[model samples]
Target: MSGAVTSVFGIEPGDHAYLRYAGDDERRLLRAAHVTAAAGRGERAVFVDAGAWGGHDPRALPGGGQVFVLTPGEAGFAGGRLDVPRLMRVLDAQADEAARLGLRGLRVCVDLDEVLAVTPETAPRGDGGGPGRCPLAVLRGRSRPPAVICHGDRARLPEAILPALAERHPLTLDAATALTRHPLLCVRPVRDPAGLCLEGEIDDSNLGLLARALETAPLDGRDLRLYVRRLRFADVGAVRLLAHAADAMPDGHRLVLHAPGPVIKAVLRHYGWDRRLVLEEGDRG
Candidate 1:
């Protein structure tokens, strides 16, 4: 891994960005940006070339740090069958090794266009399985999460999967402008009683992001109060996730939904979900 820091896809350490490039020039520019950002942060970088290498030289990258390259076949993958778990394990091990080597951190880049071409329609869920299984869901909220950039050829990637992929990432990069922005879904942790403050829309596409956030919340067996007053809308999937969280609460503990909007409340009532979870009307706790 190289210890060079430069900015690519407008991404920094502790952030994840998705980049959709148009051509080889754009791809190389973004790759250089990633290497530059990692080098500037004094971190090593790992580039996973999912078949887009095309004789590119890693040494030619601007970063002075070590750059580790992993081709698709060398990463224990063949065709559409993706061993996501094994891939994650390898990345985790690499991060540990980087830390041991006294590097500040690690940056990871994946060629999404190539990965998707070989990613089976029914890929292994690999720990993120449930009602809505997201294969790359495990990449979120790691203990020492590296700056991840999933690059793709916009014209070649499937349109249907774009929203799903974007929701899994907190930040996105516009290849044309190299700008980054966050999606609507936001999960903020409340400290006192250890609850969640959710805002924005929640539906099938991003429901797992909410579930992942709830799973990691520091409820500590206490009543889990969800402040969703700022939430604009939610679908049946969001309701299901909330109900699951409510059911997991211990005896004497409750799952409370504070200040849910009229539409949300009506949906909960219509499906009799209000009976399963507590619904508070106003600011009163």
Candidate 2:
């Protein structure tokens, strides 16, 4: 599976890929080809069509993949409103079925902008009102999960939702940069408590990337918790950035560092960041 390129954005597993397209028929076919290639590599590809199969060719889809055409007022909706929970349940069932079939994992390609646009009232609340409650939030909370690609039309999606969307998704791509490759660093948003998770290694090479990720994090005046359990290494600069994030938190709110090992803990204490940040050991749970 390591040899297979499971994501259209070339991102690693357990990361969300955001793709911005111009909403043309050609672009739709290109997107289908990406998903089809993933399905050919033993991954169960599921594409949720917000366009309801208009101008798309099912014959182009690879074998052993599923495509759902979601109509706004379809029977799956409640009172003409798209049922977010029910939609999620259907995806969950697909994941289960994929596991039973002994496939690598499920790969979901969805156009959430269309979904949200149709159901304006069901738009996800971003003020930290509830943890792991929103559909997107619930999807991010899953551990050891599938590869997901979220599609959005550049002209159609509202500007207000892009920041929140980018925060949840690590790799953002557009039609022009869709095929470009990126460095390997897994930075994902935590769902239950609503924070950020850092995996893989952080070093001088990717410091700028890390800074941009931190800047775009949806802190929103709430306590920002960073889970670094899977983080293998952090240079001094990275540690300083973490300290700065803590210091930059709003008054009365704190930045919590979760599960930093002895080495990272010692570095933080040595730099006197122990006074600036709240450090916690053990599992994030």
Candidate 3:
């Protein structure tokens, strides 16, 4: 149980893992994983909820670990806006309480679905500026708890803000796809190159997810590049999907794949799709 949380969620103690969930089902899965992991590690778990828990009450977890559900109002929200600083204070206090109770560590899952609904322009930021700039950054620096900053209901949060928020954390996982202990595939939007960054494996199980990513990606008439250097394995079905997406693009607009593996290239070449999809052998760096 020493590395229970890390083994399950790929999140180490005192590290912040960002989760972008599509809906409540994914959120529930992640929440359940966190609860089980924290209990295994004998750590007190605090769920800071802002309408993401669906009105679930806090209860005692297994192995003598306790769970606390915190609301925005309980964290001291003065005005109409959700004060991020106050939220940090609340989280710190919870950590202190966990320590006083002789718990091994603290684990927090913050559901920011309601928070993002109100502030859709950008992610919530704190007052101070520096290494520990944003509220979540400060939380990471202080408590060092294995924190899951859940950006729930992906439709509510703007895609433009995902990159900036993701950069602040060590790991960014999509709840819709990252169901296992270790992530199978991670699809993230690239801003400058105007493409999608695909990491990990893409198989039949996650082919539909990849299709949705390509369809929803910001697509202009220009080339829709896919940064696949970190993508280790992609099955034939996934390769075919990419080729079809590239073929569907407007004239002179193709899907550029950077550092595609042998499997992808062989599949495309065998199916006569290598011509339609632009494959770059060299690294994009």
Q: What TM-score fits each model?
A: 0.50, 0.47, 0.51
Best-to-worst TM-score order:
3, 1, 2
Q: How does each model score on lDDT?
A: 0.63, 0.59, 0.63
lDDT of 2 by residue, 70-156 (tens): 343331333323555666677678777766665545666667665544223333333223212224434565765666677777667
Global local distance difference test of model 2: 0.59
Question: What are the clash counts of all predictions, listed in order?
Answer: 17, 0, 1
**Which residues of candidate 1, in runs, are more than 4 Å off?**
1-10, 51-65, 117-134, 179-285
lDDT for each residue of candidate 3 in 1-285, tens digit (9 for 90 to 100): 111233334453556677777776776787786766555344667776665455544543344446777765775443334566777678777777777776545677766545433332435444322222235544666635445555555776667666666665666777755566445779988776678888866666788889999988875348888888766556557777898898899887888887776446655775688988888766652
Error of 1 at 15 (Å): 2.6
Most TM-score-accurate candidate: 3
Cα RMSD to the true fold for all candidates: 15.7, 15.6, 16.2
Ranking by lDDT: 3, 1, 2
Clashing pairs in 2: none
Which scores better on TM-score, 2 or 3?
3
